[model samples]
Target: MKVKLASSYGFCFGVKRAIKIAEGYEDSATMGPLIHNQNEIDRLKTDYNVGLYNNLTDVKPKDTIIIRTHGIPKNDLKDLRKKDAKVINATCPFVTTPQQIVKKMSQENYSILIFGDEAHPEVKGVKSYGEDQEDVHVILSISELDNINFKYDKIATVAQTTKKKETYLEIVNALILKNKEVRVFNTICDATFENQDAARELSKEVDVMVVIGGKNSSNTKQLHSICLENCQDSYLIENAKELDPNWFKNKNLCGITAGASTPDWIIQQVVDEIEKY
Candidate 1:
């Protein structure tokens, strides 16, 4: 079997920046998983001495704390400052843009509508910036928009950086149709668009598709979903060890793609393992 790599795969600029920032601060801990890839996080722990703190309360006074790329809640940052810890902000600029947008628009009295998973850390952090928490609404689908009751005449919206653009547009169109005054900010990351497009294109030509990234990663899951639409044999795996020999049996070609958070080393490992088959 032959192995082919997607045109756009592996680390995005934001993830690369966060990894470099984390590497610079040895003996420090990140408030959360930096970029959702456990293998890379483990690499950082072994090589750079960076630690993970799942909660804010786990952070200690005077500790050097590197904020995760997803960023944390507004109050959490304030609490970190109060703890007298040395804070290293590694939040992706793409994620930070929506947070600032929510803060500004909400302060100006526009009801905030975020098109994303409500439980996601990125959405949680962005929602916390809203001046009026009651006015902020997070929805994964356009159907959920109908359930929201806006207290203000005007509404502002933003999307999760890793979400599907097509769905976001549908949500935006629905908001415009329902409200006279609506502000729409396209917050989806460009890397997400490229990765999804590449994955879509590659999946069509391969007998089997393998998407490499952390299972919890939103963008990785989106890639797997896109691939599955084109190729039924698509699989989502974090590393090379998860690749099953049987999946490639009698297959002529295998296509591989990775999420924005996936590292090149991991991708190469998977490629090497596939090549052996």
Candidate 2:
């Protein structure tokens, strides 16, 4: 049996930078998980004494607060500033691009349309930038676009950094038909595009595909979806412990790809375990 790894996989620039920032601070708490990977979060907790908090109210004034890579809502930052908490911003610059665009466009009276999951932290942060959250619409697909009744002639659209380019463009193209004037910004991260493309290419050449990453990671989920389209036997797992030998019974070549937040050690472990078969 042969094990193949995607050329572009594992921790991206943002995740690496966030982890480095977190490691530099002691007894610091992140607004949310610094990145989606549970293993890496656990390692940080044990090694760096970092903590995680989901709500702003839980943060203490004297404690250092690390902003997540996905970023926080605009109002949340203002509230934090009002407190005495020491803040360390770890938001990816890629995610910040959309937030800035949304803020500027909303100020100019253009209705905001975000191509992403409404519940996602990154999307919520982007939506908060708009002057009025009511004017900002989060649409995951073209079907959702049909339900939106836009009263504004000018619309500005941006996507979550981890979203697929094809899906984002498709929605933007449809939105252009409905609005007289539309401004579209493709905010998908270059790393995300390269990772997905690499995953797709690996899926085509392998007998089976393995996607390793946190289950909650949006980018990881996207990579798994891309792999599933080309390879029916693709499996999504967090670690080698979850791997079932039965899946690789007759497989000669297995391809492995991980999400942006996944660490290199986890990928290496999965590969080493697969080679044992």
Model 2: which ten-residue window has the lowest total lDDT?
144-153
lDDT tens digits by residue: candidate 1, 1-277: 7999999998999999999999999999999899899999999999999999988889889999999999999999999999999999999999999999999999999999999999999999999999999999999998898799999879999999999889999998988888989999999999999999999999999999999999999999999999999999999999999999999998999999999999999999999999999
lDDT of residue 55 for candidate 2:
88
Residue pairs of candidate 2 with colliding backbone atoms:
none
List the global CA lDDT of all models: 0.95, 0.92
For residues 33-95, could you state the per-residue lDDT of candidate 2 as single tens digits? 899999999999999999999888997778899999999999999988788899999999998
TM-score computed on alpha carbons, candidate 1: 0.99
Note the residue pairs that clash in candidate 1: none
List runs of model 2 lying over 4 Å from the truth: none
Question: What is residue 157's positional error in candidate 2, in angstroms?
Answer: 0.4
* Candidate of highest TM-score: 1
